[model samples]
Target: MDVVATAGHVDHGKSTLVRALTGMEPDRWAEERRRGLTIDLGFAWTTLDGGRTVAMVDVPGHERFVGNMLAGVGSVPAALVVVAADDGWSAQTAEHVAVLDALGVRHALLAVTKADVADPGPVLADAVARLAATSMGRVRGLPVAAPTGRGVPELAAALEELLAGLPAPDRSAPVRIWLDRAFTIRGAGTVVTGTLAAGSVAVGDRLVLGGREVTVRGMHALGEPVERAGATARVALALRGVAVEQVARGDALLTPGAFRATSELDVVLTSGDAGTLPAEPVLHVGSATVATRLRPLDAGAARLRLAAPLPLRVGDRVLLRDPGTRTVLGADVRDVDPPELRRRGSARLRGAELAGRAPGGAAAGAELARRRVVRAADFTAMGWPVPADATAVGPWLLAAGLVDELAARVPQVVTRYRQLRPLEPGPPAEVVRRALELPDVDLVPAVVRPPLALREGRVVAAEAALPPAVQRAVDGVRARLAEAPFAAPDANELAAAGLGPRELAAAVRDGQLLRIADGVHLAPGVEREARARLAALPQPFTLSQARQAWGTSRRVAVPLAEWLDARGVTERLPDTTRRLR
Candidate 1:
């Protein structure tokens, strides 16, 4: 199926042409039929000679309704540009053609209506010449009088040929349905209609709108209920979760999580100079019209800050219009997620950086290079394929040089951490992640290099050694314990020997000392010696017997007996006597 939007002057017979082709009323409103003018978008469809289905979106052509016209044509792939023979070319006709050109609509056909009232040859030639100057280059034209049906067959044949030459739509592309109509049906909750330009939609599909997920309760194509519909087809979706007042024309039904809504973007002007644009303009894309502030970056590139967020991506074509003058310019989106211009001359530098790049996946490498590190999901949301050379560290995609640079800094970071706190082994993963400015702590392990290893959830030096002062204090304590294995030093005695809590903890971590309890420090092998001595006593001895056997005072004996019990070296009986395990 091919959906084509009609464009031309107000009274040039755009609706008339569609009505004649489809044998159906293009105008739905009574006011439109009575006034003999198209006030809003009208829809009709027909089967061409070769059994090809064609849907027509009849758009209003009055200068006042240009917004409506843009909404109708934004998502369609082809157009039927109507020109009246009696009125050769008109103001709305020129504006409509300009809009199509700005939107990069390349496939179109010209219909010279009112052929019976005047000679069609002159108007057809003139209209064809004007269209050739724009993006719709040299469209095929014919004369047709809708009322009398003169040359109608030839026009339909021309349309069929034009539709035949269009590029095939990508059914696998992410779905973005730019709604043209939103209202409530008698039984259905809310219904929205749009031309599905790419991808496919099926009943029961979940679509996103305004950050909320809505289910497709029902669907129709060409007014017939269908379970599924693909690209280039006109579709109406019955939505389950939203009210009619909540949705309106120009809203979009999107594939969930497939897009990132952005308020600021950088674009390359495909048509007009950026310096001549208005400071504030309206941007139209995919049936969405948003007020924007344009900041000229260069002669051909600029930045746009939108009043409302839109789900935008690189390579998306958009039309910027100065509402005051009704002049439009075409732009190709270059960056959806742009860097902030915090410093002076940053905008100019940004423009220079973007000058040489194209849009879409072709520019992915340049994007990754500029960002250095980005979440892989962000790239997917922005509609850019991840670069092949990017290194995946957990959920992050790192530039080729970034991994090496981060790895190179790890050893220095750990060394500095150790220098600041001599007793500590290494920094925790979160501390190292923050020091490296990495997005995820899990990525720290990926960038860890030789001489630095991840151990016990902390980045550790391969040969962890205490400082000279700490090692000297530990040696003094070890010598004291060697002389009297059961006589653990008191807190004041250990403090006088320059061993604080941190120094003691560091010694324990290095296996130089064992902590029997708070304020009780012993040598590493002293616990085994105490347990051996206790075993020599009669089985199930009292605490006093164990204390005498070890020759330690009550201060050391209680903690030692408890530590032994906790270590499964001994168990206490109901009578307060202990025995070895």
Candidate 2:
């Protein structure tokens, strides 16, 4: 489905034309019916001659209701400009045209309405020339009259051609629905209606609204319930986990984390009705109306302080209007997340940097990573390529320079850590991650450059050796174990020889000692010697026989047999004896 909005001056026959074509009443309010004027947005739809369904959002044409009109057509990509032949051109018509030009809406059709009241040739020619001078250029127009249904079929054909040329919605992009209505149903908790500008939503998909997540209970597109709906379609979604009182017309339903909602933005301003924007203005973008303060930075650039945070992205075009001053400024969002200006002349430098970015206004790849470490999902949502030159740990993308710098400092960090905590094995992976200011431990191993290694999930210096005190303790343990390779020393004896539990743990971590049992340690190769002796004894042997063969006590023999059995070096029989495999 293609959705287009109706734009024109007051009393331009927009709704009347829609009623004649679709046979449905567009005006829902009794006051509007009584006044015979549109005061709010009205919706209607019709099937074109080519069988294409097009939804029409009929905006109010009165000057007093201009804000309502902007809310209705802010995100609608196409327009149908209605110019009543009897009224010719008017002030509201020019305002609508300026808005379309500011929004960069190029696809449109000019309908010279009320042909039954007067000849439409002069008005049609005048409207075409005026539109051609604006951003819409020359639009195709035809004479239309709702009273006698004159030229209604031709108008539908033109609309179909116009809609067919508009680009298809991006279903793969994140969903951002600018809600226009919210209401409560008897059984359904809350329901909101909006034109799905992009992406697709399904029955069970969760949407973010006002910092809270809501589930989609049901969906209706074109008055038919559906499991999922795509962009360019008007949809009403039944919601769960939210109340009607908590929702409003201008609130947005978005894919969580896909957009950065910030109250401050750095942008490049283009001249509109106002030569330079005032200090305060009314901002209209995607159905949102915000009061903002504009501070000029440099040539064609400024920073905006919005009254509230908006779900904005880089390269979004927004209109700044001051209803009090009657000024308008077209702004292109350059950065959604900008740093605070705390230093002298920082705003100027920031403006220069923003000006240096590409026309799309998004940050460069390296600059994006520098702002903060981003994941693959962030890259996809921002339409940035996953950088190939950077180090990727799991889903994160780290700056190559940052990774290299961290890698270069690992050896120093590990040495300092070991010196401070000599009793421990080494710094844990998390410690290394924090020392480098990384987001998580996933990137720690990747930061270990050549000549550096990670052992037991701890960063280790490749050529690391024990400190002097630990080295002396290890030497005492080695000498004692070598004299009696199988007769392990007791804990008290080892502690007396300068090898305590901490020292033993360090030796084991460094691969210099193998712990056979509690309070029992051996030289690294002593276990092999014991295993060889046990195998030489017999095919099946008792624990006592093994202790005699290895010349050790029950403490060492029991753990040795069990350790050997665990390594598949020997098997234990059902009768509680051991056998070589």
RMSD of each: 3.5, 3.7
For this target, which candidate reaches the highest lDDT against the unseen true structure?
A: 1
What's each prediction's TM-score? 0.88, 0.86
Evaluated with TM-score, which candidate comes out highest?
1
**Which regions of candidate 1 are displaced past 4 Å?**
148-150, 472-498, 511-516, 520-581
lDDT (tens digit, per residue) of candidate 1 on 1-581: 89999999988988888989999898999999998889999999999998899999999999988999999998999999999999989989999999999989999999999999999999999999999999999989999999998888888888899999999999999999999899888887799999999999999999998788999999999989999999989999999989889897888899988889999999988888887679998999988999999999864889999999999988899999999888889898988989889998888888887777886455797788888888888887897888888898778999868889989999888989988977888999999999988878888998898788888887887777888887888888788789889888899988998888888998887768888899888998886898789879999899999989988899999999999999889998999999998
TM-score, structure 2 vs. true? 0.86
Going through the candidates in order, what is the number of backbone clashes in each? 0, 0
lDDT of each: 0.90, 0.83
State the displacement of the C-alpha of residue 395, model 1, in Å, after optimal TM-score superposition: 2.2
Candidate 2 residue runs with Cα over 4 Å from true position: 116-122, 185-189, 272-275, 359-364, 378-390, 415-426, 467-483, 489-503, 516-519, 525-546, 553-581
